[model samples]
Target chain A: MLAIRRTAPDPDGRLTGIEIADRPAPPRPDGWTTVRLKSASVNHSDLAAVRGPGFEPGTHRVLGIDGAGLDEDGNEVIVYPIVSGPGYADPLYDPDLRALSQGLDGTWAEEVHVPRANLIPKPAGLSWDHAACLGTAWLTAYRMLFGRADLKPGETVLVQGAGGGVSTALISLGVAAGLRVWVTSRDPDRGERAVTELGAHAAFSPGARLPEQVDAAMDATGRATFAHSLRSVRTGGRLVTAGAVTGGTTDLDLADLFIRSISLHGSAMGSPTDLRNLARHCATGGARPKIDSTWPLHDAKPGIARALAGDQFGKIVLHCA
Target chain B: MLAIRRTAPDPDGRLTGIEIADRPAPPRPDGWTTVRLKSASVNHSDLAAVRGPGFEPGTHRVLGIDGAGLDEDGNEVIVYPIVSGPGYADPLYDPDLRALSQGLDGTWAEEVHVPRANLIPKPAGLSWDHAACLGTAWLTAYRMLFGRADLKPGETVLVQGAGGGVSTALISLGVAAGLRVWVTSRDPDRGERAVTELGAHAAFSPGARLPEQVDAAMDATGRATFAHSLRSVRTGGRLVTAGAVTGGTTDLDLADLFIRSISLHGSAMGSPTDLRNLARHCATGGARPKIDSTWPLHDAKPGIARALAGDQFGKIVLHCA
Candidate 1:
């Protein structure tokens, strides 16, 4: 079996550390099962692992957080990445909760092992690539929009950073769920394409004043867009964040938060329940994960390069068949 | 009539700008009525107005945010301090929301005028001073505990800063509502007294690691206690803030927030509904606001001094009767 692994972390967040090489098949632990990988999607977390400080110092670790594959009985399955304690009904509440590629080998290989409970039967409506996309970026966006923000139909939502995996996921999912979705991008072309390709109701330049206040806003851009997200929400609105791609620290004006009655929610990759709901919605609603590009597993370096460049509009996937 | 007013804005927050003087009674507006004040409590907001920037410059503004008085009909009432646009059911959502003493003459005067809708009839069970405390500190505390945090019974709540008006209110309210209340204070005597007099489960020095994590935490001593509040809450718990007596700005670590799934809420002086609910609960539950010291309206300077010195254990009041 061949696996894509990071021999060392890249200081500049490039693909220099990523390599494809032959590796042994993953072992099936007592309560775990193995999945023959058919497809895996690249996420910002994968890029982040390649960047630095995520994995241990010297050990080579396979680097993927999301994938779809076939089980031993030939059943198609979508893998949930989080590994937690026994009988932990909600992994989000697990104190020692961790996901793949953080301290363990991940899914960018021919075969990968996961706890039996982490596998969800893949719906026939979704392609293997789209199911792979669900495990990381799509599930995170789903939780941020529906589970955390609790947005209602006909309400407006502003998504900061129009072109990442999470931003694109938020736009498509928000639109399908009956929300009026607006997006912001630093690049005009990306902003324009968000409206046309991703079903966003409108798009704006980054930090530009919105035409009217939105009921909620999703910020994955962190310090660069946090202030704007705070200012653009209507009174009593919510702002949900999953990642801070630009920077992690920001100034929070306590007076503005309480006087305006806004709620700030910090959301990470969601619960298994949230992933299940996301898959059902996508399967039934005919919503599909947008793919920027796909490459064969043995030739994944160029895909990693494109993801690091961040010019692509959606999830970059690797075909493992 | 005698009133305590801010003579001018002070660059430094001190009582030098506050004066007790005789002023003409305020005229009742078309839809408003006058309340002959029986008691008014000193809040950190009042201290801020005296100190600087919260109020207009060169205008002598009566400086009190919480009060109890007799309406024109001779019925005792608690005045809701917020004034909003016509037909506004929820003042928090109103764009033009303004509180007493921010621009208008507040409750420190012998008589103050307020919209008829802002008055909640006082129950005979509450003393005038206790009712007076409900408009600002108690209402803010009630909203922080019940409305914003949405804490359930048996959950533990950490009330940061034990000596202030809001902290005392939170302790009593949380305990009365069946929550396990823990408090933090820099003064050992204050922390000890909180356990004995306010029914707190335990008390700790500021920023001391708790024996156990709380389900929710309330921070009023901004900058000084913000990091502690964030660190002390359990995963997925809430932290609510109303006033920052020390300072307003704080560093928010986005990664910590999202990874832990914590929610941060900003609360101001609560709505008329919350005020009414708080008054009813205090009246029935036998929970009363602690009065640190009471002075005659004309002799309020020393009371302000004690409040500014931050050594008082509870609300400082002015008796106008």
Candidate 2:
């Protein structure tokens, strides 16, 4: 099978980690079956796993977290990325939780193995590219907004760092759900496009004071925009985080956090229920995951590079089969 | 009328900022009525107001936040300390939320003037000292456990600092409400007392590993205990904070917060509804605010000194006649 695997560290900003090569077919375990992967997408998690603590010199970890595919029984489905850590606990809370590429071979290949439970029927008419995006970044945005923050229609949500996959997903989903969506970006162009093209009500320069504090906020850019996002939420509002690309740690002004009754919720990916709802939402013309660009399976390197450099404005996809 | 007022900062820790002296009787304005204060209790807010940004050397701010007294109609009542900031908005959310001493005169005097709505009838069996403790610290604790964290009976709650007013109130109220209460304190004696005297199920040294993560936590110790409190809650659990005596900033490890779905809620005091509910709960003997000691109204200087020194373990009372 043709696949993408992480080969080394990009620690010093070399960006020389990914390898597109042929790999063995994934074997079926007791409850696992193979899917003929049709498409996959790049999430920061994929790029981050390589950028951070890289694989041991000899280890070539296969590299995708989510995908859309045809199951062994010929059913079209979206694969749930989490490999159901021991005890079937929520993957985010499990100390041993592993997404597709974390421990097992991922769906970047032509064929991949997933538990039967990981397969959710892909609604007819939802594209393989869009369905491929759902299980990781899109689902993360879903959980952060609806699951963790419990946002309501007609309320406002501020999304920080406009170009990332999750940020775009948040804007699209937030707007689709009848929210007053606002987004922020370091790049004026990205912020403008978010408003003009992504249905965001408004956009602003990073750290530029928002027109008003929002009912909730979404953050994936950690150290840089965290304090601003915290400040941008109205009193008693919440901010949900999925990934921290710039850095992880932030100074928590306890007075600001508690005195204003602000709450911050850290999110990873969605639960099974969130996944179902996300699929239903997308199928029902609710929102679409913006596709930055798509490449053939053999041409994944460039797509991964664009995503890894954080230059892409929407989810970057690979047509696997 | 005799009252305790803050005259200056104890920035050097001299603890001489408080003065007990005779003052003019409180004047009732339109929409306001005089409450002949029978008892007032010392809270961290009173101690903190002096310890932090103190008043002008020439200015004297009457020092108590909550009190039990007689209304103009000679009706026995517990005075709501919040002065109904500006638009009568939620005091916690109001930028101009002045809780008594923050702007106008507070409750630590023989007679206090407040809005007519400030009075909740004192239950015949409830002691004045206990009722006096409710509006600030006890109410803060109630809002933290119930209003903010939404903690439930039969669940476990961890109190980060067991000796302070809010911490003790959390312990007593949580236990009385059928929760499993656990407390932490730097002093071995305080930890032991919280378990033995305050009905906590267990006690731990600060940052000590708990037998299990709690469903919720209450924090007022700020920078000192905030991180540990964040780490002590189970996944999707909450921590409510009311004050930060040990300094106000802390490192928020966003990963620890979101990956575990931990939520931190900053609470100031209770809502009017929460105040009424707290009174009903206390009237039904759900919990009693621990009274560390009592002093005659004229001897308030010593009580203020004890509270400011952080040597007292519970609510300190000024018995005004």
Candidate 3:
């Protein structure tokens, strides 16, 4: 089996290897299912794990979290990225799952074994590439809007940083949910495209004041746009976040938070329940995942590089076939 | 009539004056009651009005939110400081009520007018001083624990600071409600007193690591202890804050928040219903306010000075007689 494994943490992304690897196949546990990968998407997480804090030198760590493939009976399914406690004993901070990723192998491989509950049936109408994209970014955006923020239809959502995977997903999902969406981008062209193509009402500079305050603000830009996002929400509104990219450290104005009565909800990945809800929402909305570009499995480096550089607007997929 | 009026925002307590002021006796409006104040308590708001923000320099502003006084016919009543729209709205972000003190004359005076609905029957066994504390600090603490955090009995609550009125009230309320309360104070003596007198199990320095993480935390110290309070909660825990004394700016660690599954909830004073519930709790538990010192209505300066200096352990009261 060929897999992407990190033999050492490398800032240059050169130490990560994509090669034929041999291992004893995982024996199926009573409640687990082994899925053969048909396709998998390259997320920033995949690129980060190669060089970031988790990987130790000389240790083989399997890398992918988002994948779509087939079960033993040939039934298509979407793999939800989060692998936490069997039940909801606090999904975000389960120590067991935290230790496993640093210890166990992840998805970027020929076959991945996951608990039976981690697999959700892929809708017949959705393609493998679309299902793969749904696993992480889409589910995250879905949870941010509906699950955490509870952003209702006809409300406004200001998404900071226009061209990343989660921001793109937020725009599409926000529009589909009848929310008036706005985006912020450093590039005017990208901002315009995000507005015109993604159904956003307008786009502006990262911290430029909005025409009017929004009901909720989706912030993943971290330290850069956090204060602006806090300012963008109407009094008693919310700011929901999933990732803090550029930097995770930020200054919070406690006065703004308390005086305006704002809520700051920090989201990790989607929970199992949130994944199920996102799938159902996608099924109803007739929404298809947006693919920035797809690559054959052998040519995975470019897709990973594109995602790593934050150049792609939508998911970068690696087609296994 | 005598009143404590702030002519300007002055942190030195110099802008506040106890003066002989003249006004028409409050006439009962529809659904309103005119209470000839028997006693009213001093709060940080009074000091802030004298020295904080949003007040015109020449305009006289009466500054207190809580009072226990006699209504017409000498009926003892506890003044409910919350004035809302026709029905109960969520207190967290009611825009109409946010500008309350700025919009209306407050309670630190000889006579205070309140809506008839805002008066709760004073419990016979409760002292006027204790009842006076309930309107502002005690009510706010109750909402922070039960309404905002939904903290159940036996859960651990870490109070960031212990000498302020709300902190003292929280200590009493948490103990009454069966929660193990821990408090933090910079002064060793205050910490000892918090444990020995106020039922706090232990007390630590503002940012000192606790023996164990708490299920929920209450913070009003703002920039001074926000980071520590955020770190002190266990995963899936809550941080509820109502006021910020030192300052309102603080650095936030977004990664820590998401990784720990912590939620930051901002609380304002509270609703009328919250005040009623708090009074009932006090009535049941026989909890009395921690009065630092009381002054005759003629000389409220000393108490006001103690409040301004943050020198009091609990509430500073002004007695009308």
Which candidate number has the best TM-score?
A: 3
DockQ of each: 0.63, 0.48, 0.51
| Candidate 1: tens digits of C-alpha lDDT, residues B1-321 | 789888876657566777888977656679788899999999877887777576566678788988899999899999999998865447887878878887778898898888998999898999999999898878889999999899999999999988777888899999999999999999999999899998999999999999987889998888899999999998878999887878888899998889888899988778888999999999999899878899999988888889888878678999987
The sequence of per-residue lDDT tens digits that candidate 1 reaches over residues A140-228 is 89999998899989999999988777888899899999999999998999889989988899999888999999999999889999999
Residue B232, model 1: Cα distance from true site in angstroms: 3.2
Model 3 chain A worst lDDT window (10 residues): A95-104
Scored by lDDT, model 2 comes in at 0.82
Clash number for each model: 2, 2, 4
What tens digits encode model 2's per-residue C-alpha lDDT throughout B1-321? Answer: 788777778765455777788877656678888888999988766777867874766778787788898987888899888765554346566655667887778888888888887788888778998888899778888989988888888889999987777788899889888899999989999889998888999999999999998888888888988878888888768888777888897887787776776777778887777887898888885588878899888877777778777788677898888
Shift of residue A2 alpha carbon in model 2, Å: 7.2
In the order shown, the chain A TM-scores of the predictions are 0.91, 0.88, 0.89
C-alpha displacement of B16 in model 2, angstroms? 10
Error of 2 at A164 (Å): 1.4
Docking class of 3: medium
Which residue pairs in model 2 clash with each other?
A258-B266, A266-B258
Error of 1 at B108 (Å): 4.9
